[model samples]
Target: MSVVQAMDLGLTFPAGDGDVVALKDVNLTIGKGEFVSFIGPSGCGKTTFLRAIADLEKPTSGTLSVNGQTPEEARRARAYGYVFQAAALYPWRTIEKNVALPLEIMGYGQAQQHERVRATLELVNLTGFEKKYPWQLSGGMQQRASIARALSFDADLLLMDEPFGALDEIVRDHLNSELLKLWDRTGKTICFVTHSIPEAVYLSTRIVVMSPRPGRVTDVIESTLPRERPLDIRETPEFLEIAARVRDGLRAGHSYEEEHV
Candidate 1:
């Protein structure tokens, strides 16, 4: 079923001189338990669109519904989990405490909070580091902890914005695999924003490609690869073909901007 839906969604920011159009006429529907990615150039509205869906930003026009309710309703109901580009952990809090913060704020009992934190830490492969500080972990480990914090709340939808962007290539690969396993286990709907074409293709069931300067979706590609995706899939000809298609979509969008100029 459609867990997230955006209809003719548009966003505009108030600049000093004029309004900056970040997104225009974007429409998308994400299914329950689906993994979707938004990819484009730096100035594209990938992150902006994500924020709109998360109720962190309000669109200037159109409608957005999460799980058949408004973004505000979903957000207030804590229907989704959000992982930002940075780890955003509290330095003073231990890893377990950081994960439990949400639960505590949401009024979960101490016992329930402890159970959820432990389960989520294990889910992200950080089971033993519950007592460690955020500074005590590597960049990748810190990101995993951040993800654990997001998952600790057990929200149905996950909105991730470049959560692995700062990690090294090898670390990113490892986390990508771990993320797929987590998705399989949790079955939550994930909306991720990134600039990496291969990363988008590997991690997403659907890719929403957008353009800059008035970030609008130019293409939506549904991946046909198997659910059991492996690192070796990147070397396959089919993978290359899909990557090329994504690149072409971005290029076409850029060319359209140039033509308009």
Candidate 2:
């Protein structure tokens, strides 16, 4: 099943006395339960594309569908969960309460809310920290809480925008493994945006490379690595090969942009 489909996806914003084109003619299809990543330079519209799929931004001209429905319809039905760069947790709320907030607003019963919150915290390996505040946790733990909150509602699709960008290298590595485990256990479809080529290669089934200044997808590389990815896999020749391919794709996009300019 195609969980996400983007055809001729384009976005433009109004600049001072002119229009800033963010994305143009981007096409992508993400299969159900697949892990996909968008990788590009700093201003390549990776995040913008994510926002469009999440219904946070309306495309200027294009068609985007999630699960055979429009992005707006999917959003209205609460068919997806979004995790931004920051944890975005409310400081006054405990970890469990933070996870439960969505349930509360969505009108889940108290018992079901508790059950889901507990299970999600466990899913993210934050079971014992339910009562702690976000301020009391480390940066990585806070991001996990945010992810837990995203998963607490049991949404089938997750849209993550550089969720681990703030963490240190060790913490990022730990979370990467945990994320793969979670994906294996839950079978949820994930669209992750990141600038790190290695991170994108390690975590994705496919990597979409985009270019800046009217961003467009230049290449989509399918990962050939086995599904049972491990930390040690990063040091293997296969992993390096895929990473090099993605790097080439990124560089190709940049070269094309320079030629056009």
Candidate 3:
């Protein structure tokens, strides 16, 4: 089934001069259990498109649907979970308590919240750190806590905006491998936004490469790699081939302009 669908989607923001076209003529569909990555240079609207899916931004035109419903409707139904670039955890709350916040808001019973938090923390391999404070944990561990919080509600769709972008390469690579395993175990659909070609190619079942400014889809590359990928799989010829294509797509987008946040 299609978890997300966008047809001729466009979004623009009003500026003092006129307007900023963040995305234009964007069209794509994401299926259930698919790990799709949106890759482009900064200001290419990768994060903007992801935010549109989460109903954080309104499109000026075109149509977008999530799980057969409008983005707002799907959001009210709790159809998706969003993990921002930062950990965004509350320093005052325990790791588990932070993960339990959504459940509390949704009015899940205390027992139910407890169970969900435990399971999700376990899934992210942060089971033993439930009592730790966010500031007490390492950067990578804090990000895992944030991911556990997102997964706590058992949402079918996960919207991640470069969740590992701030981490060191060694940590990022490890988390990437762990994320694939978590996706396999849960079968949740994930929409990831990233600027790194190797990260996009390494982690996605399909890579959506976008152009600059009024972000447009330049290319969509499907991975030929197997599901059970080891970290070393990145060193294989097949992996390099996919990475090259993504690189070529970014070049084709003429992303030589200065990057914007």
Candidate 4:
């Protein structure tokens, strides 16, 4: 099943004197169980497109469907889980409690909430730290907890916006590995946005490259590497080839604008 479908999707923001186009002529399809990453420069509509999927932003033109329904309809059905760049955890709540917050709001009973929290925490390898607070955990651990919370409801679609961009290199690498394992085990459709070519190439089944302002997809590169990727894979020739293609796509986008001007 196609989890997300967009056809000539466009979004424009009305500025003081004119309008700013965030996304334009974006046509894409994300299938079930696929890990798709959006990569682009600043002002490119990577996150904007993501937010449109979440119904956080409405498109001004074209058609978009999530699981065969409108984005707002999909959102109302709780069809996806979103993880922001920051952990965004409540320092006052215990790890388990934080994971259960969504369930609680959804009217899940106490027993069911506890069960879901325990299982989700285990999925993120945070089983022993259930009682700890966010500040008590390391940055990486806290992000893991945040992911656990997102997974608590067992949503089939996971939307992550540079969830590891803030972490240190070593921590980001570790979390990236863990995230792939988590995705493999869960088989959730993931739509991630990132600026790092290596990160996009390492994690995605397909990478979407976009232009600058008035963002439009310039290329969609399907990954040739095996799904079971290790950190060492980044150093391989095939990996570097894909990275070079992504870099070239970004440069092409820039050159397109330069030629037009």
Candidate 5:
């Protein structure tokens, strides 16, 4: 079954003189249990497309569905969890409370909320820090807590918008490995948006390359690497080849934009 399906999708923001096209003619299908990453230059509508799936941004034209339902319908059904670029955790809440906030709002009982929060925190390796506040944790640790919050509800689909974009290299690398384990353990369909080609290639089963401004899918490259990827796999020829293809796709998109402008 397809977790997400987008057909000729387009989104435009109204500007004073003329409208700004954020996404145009995007066609993609993300199947169940797939790890798909969107890679493109800044302002390429990667996050816009993600928001469209989350029903946060309504498409101007074409159709988008989540789990065979309209984005709005799916969102109302709590079909997915979204993690933003920043952790977005509330500073006032302890780690467990932060994870349980959604459950609390959703009317989950205290016992259910506590159990879900505990399981999610363990999944993100935040078990022992349940009493800490957001401000008390390091950047990477705080991000992991954010992820635990998203996973607390056990949503079948996960939408991550550059969740590690701000972390230092070592921390980012560590989280990337942990994220893979989390994906493996949970079997959630993931749609991640990122600017780094290597990071996209490393994390995604398939990489969707997009153009600038009026973002369009220029290419969708499938990875041949095993699902069990080590950071060092990046140094291998297969990894390099996929990264090169992504680079070529990005460069081609830029060249097209330059010529048309």
Candidate 6:
């Protein structure tokens, strides 16, 4: 089953000058268990599209559905989990308590919450740091805890908005590998947004490249690399080839914008 489907979807924000188009003519389908990445220049509506999927923003036109339901319905049903760019953990909450927040809100019994929290923290390799506060953990570990919070409810679709973008290269590389392993183990569908071409090429089963403003998908490149990608794969010829195509797609978008504007 398709995890997400969008058809001619468009969104525009109200502005005093004029209506600003954020996304235009975006049509795509994400199948179950696929890791799809959206890579484009900043202000390209990658996060906007993700927000629309999460029901944080209403579209101005066209249609979008998550797990065969409207975004509103899907959101109310808790159909997916979202991880943001920052590890937005509450500083006062311990790692395990942060992970358990959702379950508590859902009124899960204390026992179930404990079990889920324990399992998710372990999944993110944070088993030994359950009592640590967010400020006490390193940036990478804090982000892992954020991921655990997202996964605490076991939602089948994960919407991640550049969750590792702020980390140092070494830490980001490590988290990228860990994320892939988590995806493999959970078989959850992921929609990721990133600005880095190398990160998109390395992590995605398919990469969707969008244009500048009024974001439209310019290209959707299917990765030829194997699922079990190591950190060194980024240096391989095949990987570089895919990254080049993504770069070309970005350039094409800029060119189109320049000519038309």
Which candidate leads the pack in lDDT?
Answer: 6
Model 5: C-alpha RMSD to truth?
Answer: 0.8
Show model 2 residue runs off by greater than 4 Å.
none
Cα TM-score of candidate 3: 0.97
Our model 2 lands, by Cα RMSD against the true structure, at 1.0
| Distance from true location, Cα of 94 in model 1, Å | 0.5
Clashing pairs in 2: none
Which parts of model 3 have CA positions greater than 4 angstroms off? Answer: 255-261
Query: Candidate 6's residue-wise lDDT over 88-118, tens digit each?
Result: 9999899999999999998899999999999
- Candidate 1 residue 101 C-alpha distance from true site, Å: 0.7
TM value for model 2: 0.98
lDDT of each: 0.93, 0.93, 0.94, 0.94, 0.94, 0.95
> Which ranges of candidate 1 are over 4 A from the true structure?
none
- In candidate 2, what are the lDDT values of residues 1-261, reduced to their tens digit? 799999998999988989989999988999999999999998899999999988999999989999999889999899999999999999999999999999998999999999999999999999899999999999999999999999988999999999999999999999999999999999999999999988999999999988898789989999999999989999999999999988998888888879987
Each candidate structure's TM-score, on Cα atoms with residue i matched to residue i, is 0.98, 0.98, 0.97, 0.97, 0.98, 0.98
Q: Model 5 segments beyond 4 Å from truth?
A: none
> What's the residue-level lDDT of 85 in candidate 2?
100
| lDDT (tens digit, per residue) of candidate 3 on 1-261 | 699999999999999998999999999999999999999888889999999999999999999999999999999999999999999999999999999999999999999999999999999999899889999999999999999999999999999999999999999999999999999999999999988888898889999999877778989999999999998888999999999999998887874443543
Q: Model 6 residue 175 lDDT?
A: 93
- What range of 10 consecutive residues in model 3 has the weakest lDDT sum? 252-261
Q: After aligning candidate 1 to the native by TM-score, how far in Å is the CA of 13 from where it should be? A: 0.5
